[model samples]
Target: MSSSNSVEGSYSKRCAACKHLRRRCAEDCVLAPYFPATHPERFECVHKIFGAGNVARMLKAIPVQERAQAADSLSAEAYWRVQDPVYGSTGIVIQTNQEISSTQCELAKIRAQISMYEAQMATEQQPPPPGLPQQQGSLGSQENMPMFEPNDPFNFLN
Candidate 1:
């Protein structure tokens, strides 16, 4: 029916940005693809952090093919800015870097432990020196174990 067609036509014509701006969304509107009418909050957040004019100018400045990625980046930055007014995304980056470093250090330590165990096993399997008499129950005793320094620095790259 004509009524249903008109409703669909009206709904598809306005994007979130244009609707928020109280203007019609032209067919060539750059913001339309990124900010559809269904998710007005995305456009609102981006608008609040980076003004509508700035967003429009930035989108226009970039290549059309890269606009979607730019929009996502802008939205994420806006979200971070809202969550952390002072540091924003920088705080998140620093925290993530610290966590990665901690995990790398832990992995290095475990690898070192595994290496030590393998060395011990290899030594245990080898026959004693030709002239030396083997002591009973002393082959794998704790007293003869080599001391491993807990404070040894382990480089993940090495």
Candidate 2:
């Protein structure tokens, strides 16, 4: 049991960062908790992009409590850098923002249509006073209902 525990302890001690660098992992090693031995590939990708020293420095600079979040963010940035050498994560962020804006624009248009439909329905259901002529057509007399022009994001309203 003692021998098995020693072997397990030794194996667990070699974190991905230390293993990749061919160095022993110290108990106080900042990267040890974030980059464990199980995922060497994660360390390799981060090392390739940010270098081991830079990562160590970054981790050390951050507050102890926030180090885990910082490490995860670094990992994500490294992944994005590997995927897109030029634009990296910023390109994906911009694209996502544009998509959100487009969806919001579409939603606005749909809401405008719903409002128009509801107004039209309301006018048609109500009887025109006692002496007024019976209104004809889908929109009845357009004078009563307010016109709604859906704002187009792509084209300017003239």
* Among all candidates shown, the one with the greatest TM-score: 2
Model 1 per-residue lDDT tens digits across residues 74-141: 99999898889898999899999999999999999999999999999999999888998666674656
lDDT of 1: 0.90
| lDDT tens digits by residue: candidate 2, 2-120 | 99998778766899999999887887888999999899888988999999999999999989999999889989999998989998999899889999999999999999999999999
Highest lDDT model number: 1
List candidate 1 stretches off by more than 4 Å.
1-8, 63-66, 135-158
Q: List the residue pairs that clash in candidate 2.
A: none
Lowest-lDDT window of 10 residues in candidate 2? 149-158
Q: Which 10-residue span in candidate 1 carries the lowest summed lDDT?
A: 149-158
RMSD list, candidates in order: 14.3, 14.2
